[model samples]
Target: MALRACGLIIFRRHLIPKMDNTAVEFLLLQASDGIHHWTPPKGHVEPGESDLDTALRETQEEAGIEAGQLTIIEGFRRELNYVAWEKPKTVIYWLAEVKDYDVEVRLSPEHQAYRWLGLDEACQLAQFKDLKAVLQEGHQFLCSTAP
Candidate 1:
């Protein structure tokens, strides 16, 4: 069976601790192991959990942020598939906006660092083409609708 992962494309706006229609920033975590790549909070799905549930849980576990703390952007989801460890892996992501605290991010041994980046930097560091494309699409969607 293919490996499955899920996560949020969590973003903040213009230095405010709230979600706004303009000036967005994105959350990315640097991995502690493997190639040490940066990405949105995500992980393998566990027993009997839905993909969306895993996304929310992984966000909380990896970034110290919870689903209740974010406003999920509606009508936006993306799936990426690539080979890892000689097998296919699929990752699903949803866009969300941070709304409460800017608490210090906590990383498990799975990640070594974290950053909140503007769109371009986030895409550049994302490295994976599918993820970069999703970041770009999310930014475009925000810009087109922001007042």
Candidate 2:
């Protein structure tokens, strides 16, 4: 059976640096185990949960950022498939924006640290190809939709 996970492609406007525009920053979390890879706030989906619900729940559980604190972007959903623990895994991501500049990110024990990074840095830290692609897409969506 395939493992399933979900999370938000969270970004804050006007926070990215070196882009000249500097209006979008992305969120990434460093895992506490395994390869110590960096990823968005996500984890295995609990039973009987909608994908979006899983995303929302995992975001809160992993990043301590609840649904009420973010505005999920409209018309954006992405899926990625990979191998983990010798089995297939699928992860879904939805674009979301942090509603307040001063809101603190409280991470759970599953992660060691979190960082808000701009396009280049975020892509670099994400490392995983599929994850970096997702971030790129999310960043593009934010840039195109900026007011």
Candidate 3:
């Protein structure tokens, strides 16, 4: 069976006179072990929990962000399938906006560090083709809907 995970692609719009894709920043957390890869808040899906529930719960546990503190963007979701440790893995991500850019991020022991970066910087840090694509698509979605 494939391992399933869910997460939120959390982003915040920086308040500035000129608002564009560059004004958006995404939240990424560095793993505490292995390659120490950076990824958005996510975790394995617990038995009996819905995918969105897992995403919200993981976001809170991994990034100190609660469901109430984020605005879930409708119509934006991505699923990635890959191989990890000789097994198949599937991850689902939903686009969400941080209600306040100033909210604090408290990392759990599972992660050693966290950063909020623009699309280019985030793609550089993500260092994975699928994740980079997800970030790019999220940025384009936000840009297309911006006023």
* Per-residue alpha-carbon lDDT of candidate 1 for residues 1-147, written as tens digits (9 for 90 to 100): 889999999988763556533567898999988899999999899999999899999999998887788898888888989998899999999999888547567787788899989988898899888889999999998887776
Determine the backbone clash count of candidate 2: 1
Best by lDDT: 3
**What are the per-residue Cα lDDT tens digits for candidate 3 across 14-82?**
766655334899999999999999999999999999999999999999999999999999999999999
Q: Higher lDDT: candidate 1 or 3?
A: 3
Candidate 3's TM-score reads: 0.95
- In model 1, which runs have C-alpha deviations exceeding 4 angstroms? 15-21
Looking at model 2, which ten-residue stretch has the lowest summed lDDT?
A: 14-23
- The most accurate candidate by TM-score is 3
- TM-scores of the candidates in the order shown: 0.90, 0.92, 0.95
Give me the runs in candidate 2 sitting further than 4 Å from their true place: 15-22
Candidate 2 yields a Cα-based lDDT of 0.88
**lDDT per prediction?**
0.88, 0.88, 0.95
Looking at model 3, residue 62 earns an lDDT score of: 94
Q: Write one digit per residue (lDDT tens) for candidate 2, span 12-70.
A: 87634666565678889999989889998887788899999999999999898999999
